[model samples]
Target: EAMLLSLYDHACFVLGHLEWSEGMRGNHYLACIAGLSVAAAYFPACRWTAQLRRWCAEQLRIEARYQFLPDGGNFEASIAYHRFSAEMLGWATWFLNRTPEGHNILGRDREFWLLLERITTFTEQTTYRSGVAPQIGDNDSGRFVSFLPLADDAESYGTWHADPHPYLSQRNHRETCALLRAVCRNEEHILDALFDDQTQHRQACFYAHTFGVAVLRNAEAEVFLRAGSIGQRGKGGHAHNDQLSITLALDGQEVIADPGTGIYLAQPAMRNRFRSTRMHSTLALDSVEQETWCEGGGEALFWLTSDRAHARIVAATERLIIAEHTAWHLPHRRVVRLEDGTLVIEDFFAAPSEATIWFHLHPHVRADRTGEGVRLEMPQAHAILTASGGATIMLEESLYSHSYGVWTPTRAIAIQPSGTRTQVTIRWQLRS
Candidate 1:
């Protein structure tokens, strides 16, 4: 009894400092509040327990209402952060429900459940058939808690001895679906369909207007596109300047991927490079980034100003999806068509500009330029990329980061127009 009390006392002290120091603002802040609340729930006789419970309850309510957008997307603009927030909120709800006095502290139970449903559905819809998110922004590969056991091989996490990122093989989508299944008891069918790869591919496109994201999937291919604001309200937290960028997967294998985020604080140059427009699978005008980076301290970090882009799904069908975005004072449109095993992408720029359209290939994919275009060869897939409008097509050295703090040398196909003002159309046809 004495040892248990001592441990409880230590928890109380640490949680009290965390609550008092870091107010509930961001994802991590809310997590701290949740942890403190759970700790306080154990000491019902403590004088501060009631007040702490009320404070934590109010913080959770605020986060559910404001931190998450109406469409169920996290305002931080990072899918990985979304997962973190969802897990923290889920644990907090569960802990509070376990106590008699805290059962109704969530205020409107319906609203809370609706928020959870929206977030989970968004995650399910955004996930690729291969069971991974698009790596849209900064992916530190963070998670709030680990219910599953860690891998026996420590090196699977990363090269760094104490890497905070999750193991490379960890499937966040599968884990998230499991969490949602437990929380959303009544929505078994929705979760079942999400978990089933065959069912997910039956759906044509998942479009979220709130986040300006679109995921088009066919039986054999999937394409993820981003044409929205840089983070929430342009704060650019955990967001990349990758407006109108796309990631492609064929037959459950990544062919073209979003050059994922490298180390954040350890290497600022690499961080900036990874988030730059040139590194994404998009069109870059004279190698200039779509959004200007502002240096800030702490959570403020970096943001983009005067580069708010708006994207809309112009047309979508079972086999075709057309979307457009205006950024860097230019309007760019992308039309994707998937038929059988072939996927074709057509890019249209509104005005004349010296732009380079990049297609960053996966590390395992081999590329070579032929007379017609570039041929990309993989283990079980092949792609032929050809461009019109007299564009100069070439392959350039690039880098691909499969996880945080790790990078591999690769290649990207660059299509540059011969003149400043030209209508360039590039196509990618996949062959068996």
Candidate 2:
């Protein structure tokens, strides 16, 4: 029983040391509260157990109500952190339901289940047919627990090894859906509909207005677009300046891809580079970033603030999605449409502006510039990008990181319009 007592002591120590102030709010705070609940329930006889339980219960309620939106999207704006928060709350609620004192904490509450349901819905909508979540924002691949065996190297604790695609393919949507099914018991039908491939294919568009994200999917292709706030109120923490960016997949293979986040903290230059506008698949004006990163000491390090850039979905339908974002007092709009087997993107600028629209290709995809436009060749898929309005098309060297600390050389198509306003179209034709 000495081991059990030691574990209890450690739990108490963790609970005692958690900073309960406003500054300590976030995933860290929620994790500590969850640990405290587990500890209190385990050692109910402890003198501080009652008080700790009350504090944790109240904090859980408050966080559930405030940290997440009405549609269940985490206000933090990081999809990785969204999953992290959901797992924390899921564990806490699951553990609490087993204890007599905590049985009613999340009991039969419509609002509570609705929150979880919406979050799960968002995740389902964003997940690709290959079971990978689009690397929309910062993705450190953080997890609360490591159920899988780890590599022997200590430094490899946080860094993703090789390509994260295989790892993501193994656990991304399946686990999240399973957790949602377990926690929100009343929402089984919703989960079933989301997980069912037949049902998902019939649905053309999945738009989360609350998060400003839209996913267009069909039997043969999937497109993910981002036109949302720059990472929670433009603070830009864990957010890339990729407003109006798009990621494309065809025949269950990624073609145009988001350069997944590279190393963090260890290499600030690389961090800034990976999060820069040049690395993303979007338009960059005068090569200026939409948000500026501040290099400060300690926790404020790498904090970013936008230059008054904002994004909104102006129009959305099963076949088309139009989104607009304003940066530096100039509005840039992107219109994406899926017609037959062709995927078309039309970019519009309010004024004559020197801008470059980028389309970053997956490392495996081959590209050749044709007279009409560019020919993209991927496994089981092919596409041709045709630009109008006198746009100059060129290829540039780029980088793609499937995992942290590992970067691969890639290429991106840069479309520079000669006039103030121009339209470029990418016609993707899948080969059977």
Candidate 3:
């Protein structure tokens, strides 16, 4: 319990800082409310009155932010996150009302009602079948954040359930319903049932569909990547430019990545460019990401953290897991692990690929060229990376994700491992 409070305190501190960041744009209602919720969490343990008062003032500034977005969607286009933000804000306001400090903050009840009305209308419209919120940016965030259960007995009038939606399932529907209840706040029926109905899912795999796959870690230390032939299904809005492209997480950080969707434009050209490999942690073959976002996408998967059991044969331990499919071919399972301060990668593909594999690091990681080797400088540590084969490139970065370091591929291949059935093998080991 003490540790949890400390974590909450840290989160409140971070949120307070972020709330003050220029990038936050104070107009982000949900984010501000999330900030308020974090602040509320700290009230029990916080002792600095001046800082607490400042936090309350910041929350008050954001009270009117939600009114700016007449449409109710977040700036990021994720309905589920928006709902989660709304619920958090609602609870924050309610909590404040019950406390002496909160009484001062919750003085303006009219603002809460307006924000709730707009948010509820927006949420009800986005609820599709299978209970899965649309697989959009930052869509998977709310799954891990816990909420104090609220009573929700209101009968949903116009909920839309999209059967067999690509990213949503029956369990997803339950969450959506729970959020609906929270928005309506019909206190008689506890909405915790919806959350209780399904065992919580970990944050490793976020969304995997026909064309694109995206995964995140509970620790936010590593990112796993894999893509397949499903990009042509008109889901590029949810797709990354990664084609069999995998991202890695090290020490709770991203060393290789797709920068993720930045902005939304009604134009197709703008959206298509964001989904290209240039933005992902994959090799740029002739500077191309996918052969047309539709041509020959293949399946990919990743495993996070070190699986020591698999580290003897290879120096890498997978922290993320991925499996993907290709055309005229069987499925492939790709395991990414971090072990003994090294990263090892193994691929189990059903077919042979003449294609040379490439690993691209995030452009932000600084690399030094020293003869035939590259030394990388990461946010937390540094590493020297080299390839064993002529066609492979290995680079290591001391990841900020955990206690150890992680190495990623910049150039390599998914080849048959030394005449073995396994198609690909790569390892990142530290020298003593």
Candidate 4:
């Protein structure tokens, strides 16, 4: 207990200096440092040992390096951080008996409490209704949990952590907030609904680049596509050179995906190399990606119409979409329609430009080149996809490996968009 108090003391001292850089700041780290400092003193324990003192002090120092943003957003770009901060602050407030002066060793716990709440509020505003957080940073589907709401000062601090944090131990930012609200209201039904074990929820998911395009979908096959840019403002880390990209779901599973941001410093070499456009399902003209490691440029744009000739749910019963975007730069207007129970992507682009288009699937999904265009085989689902027609598609072996898990390609196919204002199309179908 003494050691934890000392760590908190050290954190307060370091943060008093205010020297955190943009690359190293985040909300969760701040909350953890604050929470740990307060937790150490609030909870009873045996006499503090010298080793514990040293560890706590070191943690305080390390955490101080992470400063909070003006909007109370974390610099790391992950919504999970925001949720974690909120819970930490709530715990800190409850532990100190809601009095800042009570934890004398930690000094001002109130600042941490307020900051965590503010950050969480920002996250709540950004979260989509489907529960999937924006792919702002290093995110995978694995981070999901549901927490129930509880009333403020209605429960003991220790009991709150013991009860809620465990079940939501691995939940994402949105789940944590929902859980908090449920607990606050004392709504048993909401708590039970969120706590139901062993079920998967994937709805209103989106992956987007700044000034590029944002893609989302509900349970139905209809895709919601929004546009953004290449993150010219450097708003977040792991920004991609994919000036214009697409995000969608196929057969109720994630298919085309952003090769996510990998860890930094912990594995410095892996950063920025693999998370570029060569990994997504978007097409690149002339084998060119927007830019590499801050060396290229292009704007990601979008146009939406809730009128006729816009987002028609054709093949609705068959589970497909035919989307048409008004004319933009380049030479041709493009209409993307998925049919034949396979992802058949057709493109009509501007004047004759030598552009090489590639179809990239998630690394976990297998890919191989059959005499057909290119086929993706999912082992878990036991399905195969073949691509053919004017498109020269074939699955190629990949040189990069994923750290989260081991996966190999079944195939990849590249197509050359031909003709001036040419209308080119490729078809995909599933095989038994």
lDDT leader: 2
The local distance difference test score of each candidate is: 0.69, 0.71, 0.40, 0.40
Off by over 4 Å in 4: 1-4, 17-213, 218-226, 229-232, 247-252, 263-270, 285-288, 292-348, 351-353, 370-372, 379-389, 399-411, 419-432
lDDT of 4 by residue, 1-432 (tens): 677567657655654654445554444345544544454444444454323333443544344224334355544434444455445443443343223333332334445445554454555544444343434334422322224432234243223222322233232344555544443333446546346522333334332232222333433332333222222134334344332334434443334444444444334334444444455444555544344343222211111111111111122223233333222234323334444443344455553355655554554565555564344554223334443345444455432222222223323345555543322333333333
TM-score for candidate 4, please give it. 0.53
User: What TM-score does model 2 achieve against the real structure?
Assistant: 0.86
**Candidate 1 Cα errors over 4 Å, as ranges:** 1-24, 40-51, 149-171, 186-202, 295-301, 351-353, 418-432
2 or 3: which has the higher TM-score? Answer: 2
Give Cα distance to truth, residue 42, candidate 4, Å. Answer: 4.6
Candidate 3 achieves a global lDDT of 0.40
Query: Across residues 1-432, which tens digit of lDDT does each residue of candidate 3 receive?
Result: 887667667766666565443333322444555555545545564556435544654465364353224444433223334555555555554444454555565455566556556555554434332233333322333432444332122222111111122222211334544554453453333445444544323344343332133444433234444543321122222334344456554553345443333333333343444444444433333343343443222321111111111111111113545444332134334555544455445555433233334444543456665554566666545665543344334433321110001112232222222211232222233222
**Which ten contiguous residues of candidate 2 have the minimum total lDDT?**
157-166
Give the alpha carbon lDDT tens digit for every residue of 273-362 in model 2.
Answer: 888877777788775787777764444434676546678888888889999888757888889997777788888775545678888988
Tell me each candidate's TM-score. Answer: 0.83, 0.86, 0.38, 0.53
Q: After superposition, how far is residue 302 of candidate 4 from its true place, in Å?
A: 26
